[model samples]
Target: LCYFQQGSQSHSVKHYWYTSWPDHKTPDSAQPLLQLMLDVEEDRVESPGRGPVIVHCSAGIGRTGCFIATAIGCQQLKEEGVVDALSIVCQLRVDR
Candidate 1:
């Protein structure tokens, strides 16, 4: 976690690191990563007016896109009772 201040504006930053997952391999189990995502969503919910959440890893969109697609799909499922994974993945490609 970190904090930055500039001329009366302040920002609180938090980071989540999952190091056990290898660079180019799928995780053995999704439990840990799912827990991490829940924690991040909880934090984002707690802070309503903060800036965007940043998700990244050592490389590129492989893990980044997976994490984001899952997060969004889960949210959509909870709120709408359905998960449009294809739509979400397609939007991810378009947005990227």
Candidate 2:
């Protein structure tokens, strides 16, 4: 956790680094990644006014994309009982 100030206001930023994930490969277990996602989700839900959650990897494509897709897919599944990974990917691409 870290804090910074903009003007006279201060905010917190949390960072979760996964150093074990290889550059182009997935982790052997999804548990740690899933936990991170859940933690982020909970934080967002509990703090509606918080800033966006930023996730990144070394190259900002392979692992980063996978992590984002998984997070969005899981949220969609929870709220809609289904996951549209292709649509999510397309949306993410557009945002990028």
Best prediction by TM-score: 1
* Candidate 1 lDDT for residue 76: 98
- lDDT string, candidate 2, 1-96, tens digits: 899999999988888787667777768888888888888888889989787888788899888988899998998998999999889999999999
lDDT of 2 at 15: 82
Candidate lDDT scores, in order, read 0.89, 0.87
Instruction: Please give each candidate's TM-score.
Output: 0.92, 0.84
lDDT of 1 at 83: 97
Best by lDDT: 1
